[model samples]
Target: MENKSKPKYKLILDAAVEVIAENGYHHSQVSKIAKKAGVADGTIYLYFKNKEDILVSLFEEKMGQFVSKIKDEIEQIDEADQKLYKLIEMHFQQLSEDPDLAIVTQLELRQSNKRLRLKINEVLKGYLTLMDDILHEGMKDGTFQDQLNVKLVRQVLFGTLDEVVTNWVMKEQRYNLVKQAKEVHYLIYNGLRKHN
Candidate 1:
């Protein structure tokens, strides 16, 4: 027999994403998600404790895999520039390929209250750590300025890519996000002025 439990859980999660995206976190109801999932409301509780659990688990499930894959990729590359470019490209490519997840991740997930937001932050530390590693590697090899604040640089890198993705999502995902990765990396690492 098939492992029916797994699919049910995924269905509920997918429905939650849709409902939350359509209604915003404050207005999303378990009943709404249940209807979308084609399951009874009680079924959600079988897999998740509550709405907050649903959001937390959703992020953990998706981002855990994302961070793991990137970590593996970075391990295979020694050059900081290559690692950074790969990170940015993979991030945008993943979102661009799946518009549903992109919407859920870029917009709906952030609508949670302050407490839930803190939990999400805790989960995001892994991705930030990956950025820090790249910046540290660049500094060690003299590819980047050693005087740069690693923390600030990490924030800038992540913040800029996040803004770019958000703009793409907001614009109905009509543009090519991956195509901009080269320009983004150049601006962050080399700046725009012609070399003397």
Candidate 2:
């Protein structure tokens, strides 16, 4: 297997995202990804076991970076509310910047089988954990209601963002997605905020 740190691995993953987005995962072939990556078809197998592995690895690598970037950006801010806003903004901004990724993640990936979906969910846990941390921080700082249910709030937060992106993708990204981040943040923030 090729070392994942190699530039070729990223090239394969990025090409996979574009290919899968263009042709649904079931329709996308290893040769297609290899060609896009400018590598031999055999080289794909050096980094992934199969198409399923590629899909799972793609999610793992992309979501890992997504969560890390958001975590780093939010860490610089002190307030939980602003952190939440930044989280929403970054989520939208990143997806909007990479429309192919948005299509693969939001639409194409959902067509996978039960097992693949579960594997994708495993990769999603890191992102969920980031959201959980933000929620817990808000509660601890008295910015959010102490009585808030962290788990439920986390699901709601993720669901809201996921739905927004899915809608944007489904609509062919006609409108500006990042612009809606503020309203999303406002809805989620008000739901969890402590009321006088």
Candidate 3:
């Protein structure tokens, strides 16, 4: 059996993120990433199949952790209303802390082909499912509007966050993104919550 926990795998992944984020995906070369990882060029092949594999794997690895962390945080909140806030808080906080990952996720990743975009969307379903779970719980508990179109609400919530973070990333990360969490929460909360 192969050891999947090798530190070099993570090093290569991290280096790929930085290299791709700095140079658009089309411009990022395997040798560049390998050098950045401080490993031989041939070593990258031991972990990933090719450049496309690295890009897809990067999304899976990073977004997998992102979803897992947010899920853990959301599970701890008793009220559905508070869970929504925690969800938003963790999303912003995670990307804010890792600017390179943010750039890769928000900007570089989108530059791939339609087929790749579809694969990325498949990975995104995990986060979307988490939001659906929250919205359903909120409705059940009367925290959010009972008549809310669950699908639309989920898109609205995720779409708003996507836009805000993309804007922040495009602007060169000049402002504090996590600080916008409370404001964003209130905006979405007022729209979805029953009492308003």
lDDT of each: 0.84, 0.94, 0.92
Candidate 3 structure quality by residue, lDDT tens digits, 1-196 = 1244799988989999999989989999999999999999999999988999889988999999999999988888889989989999899999999999999989988788999999999999999999999999999999999999999999999999999999999999999999999999999999988965
- Better by lDDT, candidate 3 or 2: 2
TM-score ranking of the models: 2, 3, 1
* lDDT over C-alpha atoms for residue 70 of model 1: 83
Number of residue pairs clashing in candidate 3, backbone atoms closer than 3 angstroms, sequence gap of 3 or more or interchain:
0
| Clashes per model (N, Cα, C within 3 A) | 0, 0, 0
Better model by lDDT, 1 or 2?
Answer: 2
Best by TM-score: 2
> The CA-based lDDT of model 1 is what?
0.84
Candidate 2 Cα lDDT to native: 0.94
Q: List runs of model 2 lying over 4 Å from the truth.
A: none
lDDT of model 2 at position 158: 91
> Candidate 2 residues 58-147, lDDT tens each?
999999999999999998999999999999999999999999999999998889999999999889998888889989999998999999
lDDT of 3 at 138: 92
For residue 180, what is the lDDT in candidate 2?
Answer: 99
TM-scores for all predictions: 0.88, 0.98, 0.96
| Candidate achieving higher TM-score, 1 or 2 | 2
TM-score of 3: 0.96
Query: What is residue 131's positional error in candidate 1, in angstroms?
Result: 0.5
